[model samples]
Target chain A: MKRILSIMGFVFAMGSITSLLIIGMDALTFERILANEQALFQSKVLDAFDVPYTTATINEVFIQNVEAIELDVNGETVTVYRDPKTGRISMEISGGGVWGPIIGVLTLEPDFVTIANVAILQQEETPGLGGRITEPAYLAKYIGVVFNPDVVVTKNIPSADNEVDAITGATGTSTRFQIILNDTHAKLFPLLQALEN
Target chain B: MNRFWKRLQYTKWFNISKDGIFKENPIVVAVLGICSALAVTNRVENAIAMGLAVMFVVTASSLVVSAIRNFIPSRVRMITYMVIISSFVILVQMFLEAFFPVIAASLGAYLGLIVTNCIVMGRAEAFAVKNPLKYTFFDGVANSLGYMWILIAVAFFREILAFGTLLNFRVMPDTWVNWTVMALAPGGFFVLALIIWGVREWAKYFDVAAE
Candidate 1:
């Protein structure tokens, strides 16, 4: 009985101490971590829009150059950023990848049919395989690709303007990514078109 | 001078450090914590950051475990180590995310996964629980440095061969073409295996059962 009580007491003490430590750390870092995440997201948007800004000036540049449009699509609030200078549009798109959710930024030309850039904000995929989606070189392949009707990620040589090469060994991620892009574009393109007028 | 050297060698802390860093290296000899070793050794900068992070975690957690060793119950010992290690890991994660966001992002899931690194738990259970606080500190730092040096060595070759760069600087000539395969998982396996074999051979550490 004494041994069991000691074990229980130890477990309780250990749990409480560790929990308090973690809670203290989280409280200390909460604001800075949030700011860092916001800065990263803003920097990605600035890159897509071709606006040059240093880390110190990211917030200021974003505020001055980009306009955020809050739109209601089926009662869901989807916020998209637009470059006032070029009329290009950028929005966050997310979907289920093989291992976990893949979230990225998709930028479009003023026509809303051609891709300007694609930058991954967050991804949890197979490293060196599906994870290659986060590579700038891989994402660059999306640049200049047309979403006429819809985009297709193919394994074979990309003959059509709407087709981009899938990651060499990551067909599953590529297919899911294709669906994510098409679905997001279908949802947002019309709303953007209406706003242009 | 010779007597002093011999006496130092015989000291508990000195021997503990020697065993942790060289005689029983976490990677080369014991072969613990290979997952993050393989995953993050692709870049020199990454290896450095990971090494520092692991160093902090192992040292801090081991010290904590050692400090509270007497009060811990055997049945709940493993759970205690886990909680302590995880709390430290979260602290490290928060610190990095707040100040060194790039490194944190580059490490990705691996940073949080430090809780699962066998080296941290292995040291806590094997050494920290039995040893005094001062000796445990030496063991912790020495073992983490052991892991760090190996990671840096692997990253050194991998980064140069893969990108023709060392820490993103162009070390190779303009004519050098990047070896794409060197950036992949197989490259990590080959390099790590070679390192393990080389270190073992040099140390004359042969598997007795195999022999």
Candidate 2:
């Protein structure tokens, strides 16, 4: 009975001490971490819009150049950013990849059909394979691709306007990415068109 | 002077340091914590950051464990170590996320996964629980440095071959074509394997049982 009580007491003490340490750390860093995340998201939006800004000026540049439009689709609030000068629209698109969710910012040209640029915000796909989605070189291929009906990630030479070359060896990521892009685009494109009109 | 040197060699802390750094290195000899070793060693900067992070975690956790060793019950020892180690890992994660967001992002889930690195738990159970605080601190620092040096060595070769650069510096000539394979996982495996072989051979460490 004494040993069991001691074990229980030890466990309780250990849990309390560790929880206190983690809580203290969280309290100290919570604000800065949130700010960093906000800055990162804002910078990615700036990148999608091709706005010139250094790390120090991300918030200011973002405020001056980009306009955020919140639209209610299917009872969900979806916020998209637009570049005032070019009328290009950028939105966050995320879906399951082979390993984890792949989140990226997709910017479309003024016509709301052609891809202007793409920047991956987060991904857990296998590095150097499906992870190539985050590479600027690979993302550059998405530029000029159209979404007339839907975007197709193809292995062969892209022959159609909506077809883009997939990552060389990541067919799974490619297919899943295709579904994500088309799904998000299908949902948001109509609202963007309505806003433009 | 020679007598003092001999006495130092016979001391507990010195032996612990020597064993942790060379004889029982976390990576080379014991072969603990290979996942992060391979994942982050592709870039010199990444290796440096990971090494520093691991160094802080191992040292801090071991010190805490050693200090509180007497109070912990045997049945709950493992759980205690895990809680302590994970709390430190969370602190490191939050610090990096707040101050060094770029490195935090580059490390991705691996930063949080430091809780899973065998070295942290292994040291707590094996050394810290039985040892005094001072000896444990030495062991922790020495072992983490052992891990760090190996990571840096692997990154040295990898960064050069893979990107034709060292720490993003243009080290290779303009004519040098980057070895695309060197940037991939297989390259990490090959380099790590060669390093393990080289270090083991140099240290003359052989497992007689394996033979």
Candidate 3:
């Protein structure tokens, strides 16, 4: 009985020590991690705007045009997007992929007829398949895609509705991304019209 | 100190290489690490970077684990090994973030997934758990070389057909059409299966006679 108790005590002590070490390391690196993520997001946002500068330098370039907004989605306020120069609203769309999540920021021109930029925030689709959608080839496809009242993804390019080339062998991911794009347009189109009127 | 020095030079280097490359290969024979193998091999450059990173982590983790083996109680050996391994992984992550941010960005969370790689864990549990510090460290290094060579070969094939390049260096003539499917996950599965088949045949032909 004594031997067993002693073994258990040793195990508990080791566990405590290991846990404390991990916790301490995490605490030390927590701030750095957050700063890195913030910088990444800012860079992506600037990239979407085609601002030819680092996120740090973007402040000097477009100090007045872009403004970050929080959107109330089903009673939850999420950081939708920013428009640093014009105070124009941007919509942040979140969607699900076959394996994980895919979220992006779609900055719209005030007219709502064209997309200013699209930047992927997160993705975990199968690499080389669905993951290719996150590449510049696919992301570039979103730029200038018309955000009309009935925006939809279609394989046939130059169609009346919004059509971006679907990544071959990754139709599911393309379809999923289209669903989120349409949903965001549906909600924001009416809001923009009301605001304009 | 004298006995330690003697042990450091005790194991023959050629014997170590033979064991790691053929007898106990971490990838082909042991099947230890396939996660990052599949994820990064789509691009040969990424595969090379990941292989070198794994080599560094596996060697360093083995050295540390072997050094602390005596102090680690049997009841909590696994956690002790994990803590040591995670530390090395974080260090590798920081190094990559600082120097090769592009590769770092491409690898994404898969870099962190190195902690869960069976190769690192297997080395710690199987070899480092019993061997002396010196032999264990060398063993770790040798095993990593075996893994690196296999990954580079596999990635070479996958990247050339998939992307028409080797290590991002274009190989195929520009006029030739590339196979896009070779760059996808299915391509990785296909290529790995063929590699395993070839290695199996080689092993059979090279089977040693009774000593």
Candidate 4:
């Protein structure tokens, strides 16, 4: 009876120690983990447009310059000044992707047809499939292509400036990419054109 | 304190290491942890991450089990192992999520499933409970490494054929006709079967790892 009691006491003591160790580790790492996630979000958004910023720098910029807001189904409106260095009014047009969603900040050079930058915010797609749409191979196709309001998934090249190839197995994802891009351009370009006056 | 020191000497480090890789080969003989083998083995990077996660969980759990072996009830041994294993598993998940969020997300539900892996429970019950503290630690490390190598073997074939890459390093040229079929889960079973066959042959040559 003494031996059994001793064994039980030993097990209970050890269990408490293990639990304490696990809880200690979790408490120590929790804050850094949350910060890393937020930093990742900013980096992905900036990468979509070809804007260069490290994780730390991205957080610094987003905290001061960017604003987050929810929108109805059409999309959210993000407005950035043309010269962030000097204030000039401009608008960001954003929308969804097929598998999940994406928000792009579309900016134009002085000429309405020319693109300054486009930063995509969110995407959740099948990796190596729909996910490849964000790669330079796909996104570069959109770089100089003029945004058309009536964009459709087309096999035949519309023309160099107007067409982009759909990702082979991920046509739905590409189609969503085009739709969001076109809607942003269609609504925002005219508004910017009016603002120019 | 003197009793603790004496107990530590009996753990038998050499036997613990040899047993994990040979006597109780987790994948070959025990046939445990096959789920991650199928899912993560599709890519070498994913395989490595899964292996590391398992290693961390296994080593941590074994140590905790050893440290607490005496108090656990014989009737509730499995429950005790589960609690210890799950704590480490959760810790692994949180670490992966914090540092390597992409890999963590890719692993998805399988990360949580590590707690239920039979090899971990087997080690705790068969060895850690009977052994001293230090030897149990080595057993956990060796078993996890052995399991990791098998996973890498499966990943090597699947990743090369499916994506024409090894651990995300480009190998096959762009024009190479990639095998889409290799990327699917069915390919993992095929690769695992081939590995098992190879291990059996090697074991036969050396007269090792028999039953």
DockQ, all models = 0.89, 0.89, 0.27, 0.32
Model 4 agreement with the true structure over B1-211: per-residue lDDT tens digits:
9988777657677656655776657887678888788888889988899999999988888887788677677767787888788888988888887778788867876899998888889889888898878888899999998889889889999999999999788999999788877888778888898887788677563346868
Q: Name model 1 segments beyond 4 Å from true.
A: none
lDDT: which is higher, 3 or 4? 3
Ranking by lDDT: 1, 2, 3, 4
- Cα lDDT listed for each candidate: 0.93, 0.91, 0.76, 0.72
lDDT per residue for candidate 2 within A1-197, as digits (tens), equals: 99998898888888887888889989999999989978888898888787899999999999999998999998999999989898898899999989999888899999999999888888899877898888889999999999979999999999999999999889999999999999999999899889889
Q: Which residue pairs clash within candidate 3?
A: A65-A83, A65-A84, A65-A85, A65-A86, A66-A83, A66-A84, A66-A85, A67-A83
Candidate 4 — which residues are off by over 4 angstroms?
A: A1-23, A54-56, A60-197, B1-15, B173-175, B205-211
Per-residue alpha-carbon lDDT of candidate 2 for residues B1-211, written as tens digits (9 for 90 to 100)? 9999999999988998888888888999999999998888889999999999999999999999999888988788898898889889999999999999999988888899899999999999999999999989999999999999999999999999999999889999999999978777888899999999898998899988964
lDDT of 4 at A155: 63
Stretch of 10 with least lDDT, candidate 1 chain A: A5-14
TM-scores of all candidate predictions against the true structure: 0.95, 0.94, 0.74, 0.63
DockQ for model 1 equals 0.89
Count: clashes, candidate 2:
0
Deviation of model 3 at A191, angstroms: 6.3
* Residue pairs whose backbone atoms clash in candidate 4: A11-B71, A49-A118
lDDT, candidate 4, A4-72, per-residue tens:
786677567657966897788788788877887667655654444345676558887655654443223
Model 3, residue B116: C-alpha shift (Å): 3.7
Cα lDDT tens digits for candidate 1, B46-71: 99999999999999999999999999
Model 1, span A16-51: residue lDDT tens: 988888889899999999999899889999999989
